[model samples]
Target: MSSSQLPVRAAGNLRSDAGRNRAEIVSAARAVFTEAGTDVPTSRIARRAGVAVATLYRRFPTREALVEAAFADQHADCSRFFSVVEQHPEPWPALRTALRRFCAEQARDKGFTAHLLAACLQGRAPAGAAATSALEAERLTALVRRARDSGAMRPDVGLTELHLLVAGNAGVVAASPPDQAAAASRRFVELFLRSLEVPRRSGAGDGVR
Candidate 1:
């Protein structure tokens, strides 16, 4: 019938446009939600996207749905986090860079879905709760193992320890002064690494030292 529909059907450009528009909506929603909270107003998101509230509803039927999508999107961004392991092919530097980004993201995004951020004040924002944690931990353990086997890491640093450290520092990132927070990750990582390094003592007794 209409030329638009015909060409879209033929070239499939219509689907591409729809996908791009949906992504834009999600991106906008994520931006507002991260800065705001889980209870962010629907109209706020729509206004930010320069779209109608109906468009926002069409893309995300519910607040929980939008929150889940935003959480997933945040996790997806993790893969692209810079890893020196991928470049210099070592583990500690990669861990340093990755953990630094993790700290930054925790400070930046602590919506009602960011688990393990010590967001107890927010009371643990579990988007998909157990399911998401299970899926995410699987991926994290794999990365940890890879780094450990590469010999740039200590054998004791497992996923649980990693999670604890991230959780511990996330709050510091949030409450500390801006300039101090900016360097918190590097400083924390350095101290943690130093603690993890091989213990060398000029003279020490196992029970007394």
Candidate 2:
């Protein structure tokens, strides 16, 4: 999902209309940002959204505000994504499926992708926490719950640690080639998950580092 910022004229209007227009702008901005990257001018965002530049400014007075709003929408989208995962038969495979989709998105989209890098600079590029940024930390929380229940992921693993892992992997996959990066990223997840597993019974020899 993408969001666009409103221009000046779009702002200072009726409250409900202003709110609706702002929401529309955000949706447009999300698409534009994803297609054009954050470098794309906010004017372009307004044009893409079919709103006047003044309207864009009226709604979002600053680039940072627009950026934050777009990121938040992406986060909301992520929360909705959990609905898809809930359909899965179990959690481990479900987590893998989610990660695979994430890898694909990171590899393809520019706006949302750049957001990942921005996270490193404390730019707060959206990473599945915008909407739920308040109380729900579903992605990492789900992964940790599944891991702990599996007796595979270290019981010590928690939401923060898992979120970091997800963020790190997204950054890595985003920089990778668009075609095969999803497969490669999924491999990374698989290996990580495998490493968390309890050791097999000593079939033959003691484990080696």
RMSD of each: 6.8, 9.0
For candidate 1, report its TM-score. 0.59
lDDT of 1 by residue, 1-209 (tens): 88756743535787786677678777887788777665668788788877888877887787767766766755555434432235646655666666666666666666633553423222233553335545545545556676778766777877667666666676677777967875775577567666554354546556533
Per-model CA lDDT versus the true structure:
0.62, 0.66
Q: Assess every candidate by TM-score.
A: 0.59, 0.57
Stretches of candidate 2 exceeding 4 Å from the true structure: 1-24, 35-41, 50-52, 61-77, 83-90, 110-131, 160-164, 202-209
Instruction: Say which candidate scores most in lDDT.
Output: 2
Error of 1 at 135 (Å): 6.6
Deviation in Å, model 1, residue 149 alpha carbon = 4.2
